[model samples]
Target: MASAEGIFEGRLRELCKQCPPWYKNPSLVRLYLLLIAPMMTTTAWGFDNALTNGLQSIDTFMNNFGNPQGSTLGFFGASMSVGGIIGCIVGGPLNDRFGRRPLISGGALLIVGMVIMQTFSSNFGMFTGGKLLLGFGAFIQQCAASVLVVELVHPKQREALSSFFNTNIYIGFIIGAWITFGTFRMTSQWSWKLPCILQLALPAYQVVMVWFCPESPRWLISKGRIEEGRQILIKYHGNGVEDEIVRVEMEEIMAGIEADKTMIKANWQGLKTVLGTKGNRHRLWICIVTAVGSQALGGSFVAAYLPQILDQVGLTSSKDKTLINGMMTIVNWLTAIIAAFVIPKVKRRTMFLFATAGMTASFIIWTALTAEYVKHGHKGLGIGVVVIIFIYNFFTSMCWVPLVIAYPLENVTTKQRAIFFAITLFSINVSAFCSSYLNPVGLAAIGWRYYLPQCCFNALMIVIIYFTFVETKGLTLEEIAIIYDGKESFEEAVHYVSMELNAKHSEAVSHVEEHTEVKA
Candidate 1:
């Protein structure tokens, strides 16, 4: 192995050679460091998900939780999604009215309390109630932190950086899996109980750290604190120069805020505004479909109920199922990390359509293969089902993991962003609630045909993607609204702003101009 100093020197050389000097600046470096705190909330989310899913397969949890039947298990699991729906609705208004920083700081502490409730619960009702709170807190953190990170960064870095926000969740998932796997033989209730109690640590740490992180500049601007938002933009992207890029970015942000204030019907009457206009309806349609497709079709199944599903499918060994569950999360994290990088290079519409296609095919194949294993009792077929399930997860993660959450944040204006997010969260809650209840019931009732509905959902999602979704790559936040507003064609807007794409020193403010409305 190379010596520490040699390795350090090589890494430094790589950075110096591959990266520009601005990335090494102290101000930018500090801003990046601060983002770590908001991200910790996602890590905790993964930990809980991993812990919950793995524990579901454990004998101790089954006994303590009263060995829930498939539908019963689904009902108990559905409790979390129900809570998430409420959180999204409630938290959206709070976040929009208050600010992103307070929401996260407070939500972190809230999760700690909820986890404590579950940790010491004495009955199924109490435990289910705690799970509801857990979903409430997690979605609150997840939804807000997502909008926060995307809003803080530069246009070029927006998609790529925002995708990393969930990277920690996968890490938490891995840790949660191992933690459950390690405690599998404890011969006591502590195995499941300990993990629930241990969750308190993540939120506790987030409370202390998130307090120090900078508030989102976009939120600050919307509240008429323009100077503060400008300063933050400078401090992070200014690279100490207050360069042209920063000026154009601020201009674009201003245009977006103004447009949103006037045009977004929901800026006035909350939910009613969501259904008011063609524009609002269009935005909501995208939000609802993506959220429903992601949770109901592919993502939630593996994350929440896979272990139980695995055990039911004749993979009867508790340890093996749990280990596979753990490995699946690791694979999930790895694929998401890969998607985070790969997605930026690909067009948003292209990626969405392809991911949907990939998922539809994977689901259909899984249903057939699992059906074969069920009918023939073939060991090789069972193994094939396992391989395909992991493939299913990768396809799910590659598509929904990065795009479903991050795209909507970028697609809408500031005024509706929170509401748009809430709408999506609402869809997720409904879809997840259905899936959470249906998965186990579906598995028991239909065997391998359980996957048939998932296949159909993605098939419908592909149609939505191809027709309704426009290409969002290479467009700044302000410019995106033009397309939504019928101001200019996406290609026209991209071309209009093409000159300022690499404006290092400071370009004219013309690129941020969306004054010319493109006629439909």
Candidate 2:
């Protein structure tokens, strides 16, 4: 029998032969539309970043919030990170038990109320409390929605869609940035509140529309609802036909589940399984590195403190700061979208290495430019800092912006994805919390020097990713197992699929020959 690796390659070729592109099919068009519900949830994250950055530039917002600075500003920024940490802990175990749709829809429902509370807040306590709760709901949605996109999407579209998924954060950022820009002129708290209200759009869509999207087929099959899972594959993946590609996909999914059965489900035993072997341990390491490195690499600095960074560089005008924030977000969004679409056409490891290296170089230059501007009070130097900021973002937008979720998903098995992703989110929250909480304090205390650590951290990441990261380009979630499992993991299932296809081909050839003989 051919090895699992050879069979997977053959299966892929066969799938391509049998299936049309998603754009050519009506069922696929509708399915992609439904995916929008989950995909848009990242906007909540992006919106919050832009909203806070914009609010800091507004004079009324400063007066209303008592001119928050130092530790107070740090906590205000970090509140969501704290809430996200809690959400990951609460939502991770329940994800496997309740399925993806409920967590996704329920999280959106929760955010709807939180957005309302945040929008109408009259005091710091009320506003921060609302933010904390909003983070809770958003992270819950993030944990499940990301998993659903990878599992439910047609395999042919998986890499592009999954990579594009994180870029949705930029969509939210764009909305939040522009809204804050439009509102900062108001004399009342309504300036900030208005942007908070606009956040309701995507979450509201998620609450209602996710119900219309199909449940993850892999989730269904894991629960023994095999026919329901098969039907989903037939409908979405096979374009409503029970074709050979669908059969092969089902067999592969089943084989993945069977291989994973030796591992424990959820809690401590699952954690042990994730770390029990060299391969699994490596996965955990990459997950942590991806989670923490993505945030700690100066992106969070710009996201949370761009207004302050602008102030140090001599562009203290609120209008100037907000405008730069809005424009930068647009550029970042476009870059991320382009990178996402290009993911399938390029190698994952190469993108990470390039993004991290470029970011490190951009940030180091950014630091020098900032120091020069602060020292000489030169507007030209400050402008150089601004330009470098965009350059830094371009590098991040190219890789970490899209792959942060997708690459980590590639590292673990389907069964352990929920638990492992929860762990990954935990690292993200911790790193993000450090960035959110400490960035303000550090900026206030050390000014331009604070950017130095991020530069160093980013430099280290380039090395780590180059040395440890594996290429996952053009592979399915199940096919990736062969990388760690030594090409022997799914041999039995591959053999079965091979034999089944061969038998069908032979039977069809026999029927054709019989028909020709009769006609003769």
Candidate 3:
């Protein structure tokens, strides 16, 4: 019986020990654990979002909240997006200026306070306020957390850990679904309040944990704090060796910073560059579309409004809706975990095409099935629609779970990464806000025909993905810059370093052999 820690170390060692001296450190286990902590906090965002959707259908929740109707329900649903918009505006600047760790801690604290607000709210005003707070805090925390993890890890680790980071959404989704399902039968306010309290627990703990965490070395170096940044680099990447890998990665990062300055413009004018230069705009456009496409066109509208969407299609029971939502989230989680492994293996364009094609088919089918249920009064047709929705989630989850954030984080230069990400985050929330606000109202006015618009959205997304988005697969962050802006890319840079290291090693071995012969 191996202890969990022992098993983790065994796996970690098996995965990377042969790569390089630094990669062989058993303490690499700590980086994995450290990266995972912020992910749990992110789950709170997804969990509450799902919880609200489920609670919208819960009799007790509606009764307590005074039964918000179509447009109103939509507004409440969009509260998180509204908060995310604000969080993006403020948090991005704060994160860049202050550092990743502080923003993460601040976000954790904000979420804790917001959850408490929601739990104790005596009226709709209070609850809505709390919801806004939750959205703002979660968005800020997630932005900082995601960027931090992406900056902290090895390229191979990035593929799996990044996907795992987003997969935490499913954990929140499942918890939200089951909590609502379990509490839908409850005749008290505790039903809703209990979930709020549960949301508070994880991020509240993250605040304390993140405080002990180190700042991102890239960020420190970007700020010209070389000595401090080098210490962190040695700690994380060097494993105290201050060896070739550390020197090379640091040079790579510094080169990236220089390239970013040139490409983004001298004086590091990032935002203008992202919006101004023709080539950079291509990159920005892809980042925005990736963010927006993942949220808006990725079947998220279906996930967020599952219960309400089900009721519209005739699966009106909370038990069935909750049960199905729970199952759907569980499937989504497992599929996303699988997608994490698949990420490194598959190309980004392949995922976009697959997701677009599958989602388009799912929406079209769901629309048709819902129309049948509406016209024929056949309950089975509605059940069939739920199955399509599940399939839709699976496809979207594959790419949306990781690349929505990962592509932008990886594609943009270090200098421009924050602004690029902020803009992307802003775009995502805007797209989400529109979807959240419109879905229910559209459902009310047009019935299952609402999916007609979603079907059209997915159809359009397929073409956009096919034509506009370039393949980002297998490119290092530095290499990714050359894809859009530079001439000397990471692949070329790595090759140059590799030759230099081989020469250095050869010199050392030759020196040792000659000294041994002389002694003999």
Top-lDDT structure, candidate number: 2
Kindly list the per-residue Cα lDDT of model 2 for residues 1-520, writing each as its tens digit. Answer: 1223564656755676567778898888989999999998788988887887888988888898799888888888888888899999977778888999999989999899999998788888889899988899999998899999999988888889999999999988888888888988988878877888888888988898999999999989988898899899899877789887788788788777766633646578756776777777777888899999888988888999898899898899989999999999999999999998998899999888888888889999999999988889989999999999999999989999899999999878878788788888889989999999999999999999988888788878888988899888877788777676655557775676557656876998999999999999
Candidate 1 per-residue lDDT, tens place, 1-520, comes to 1112221123322332343444666766677678777867678767877876887877888888788786667778788788888888888778788778777877788888988888788877798888888888888877777888788765556777776676777888888898888888888988788877888887888778877777888889888898798888887777666666676566656655654533333355645655665766777777887788778676677878777567555687879888898888888889999999888778988888877787788778777877777788887777777888888888777868777777777778887787678778788889989877887787777766667767787788888789988676755566556655654333343343433343622343443343333321
Among all windows of 10 consecutive residues in model 2, the one with the lowest summed lDDT is 1-10
Q: How much is the lDDT of residue 188 in candidate 2?
A: 82
Residue 216 Cα positional deviation in candidate 2, in Å, after optimal superposition: 0.4
lDDT value, residue 338 of candidate 3: 90
Structural similarity to truth (TM-score) of each candidate: 0.87, 0.93, 0.88
lDDT rank order: 2, 3, 1
Model with the higher TM-score, candidate 1 or 2: 2
- Model 1 spans with C-alpha error above 4 angstroms: 1-22, 261-276, 488-520
- Predicted candidate 3 versus true structure: per-residue lDDT over 468-512, tens digit per residue: 877766556665676676464444554565565568769989999
- Give the C-alpha miss distance for residue 433 in model 3, angstroms: 0.8
* Lowest-sum lDDT 10-residue window in model 1: 1-10
How accurate locally, in lDDT, is each candidate?
0.74, 0.86, 0.76
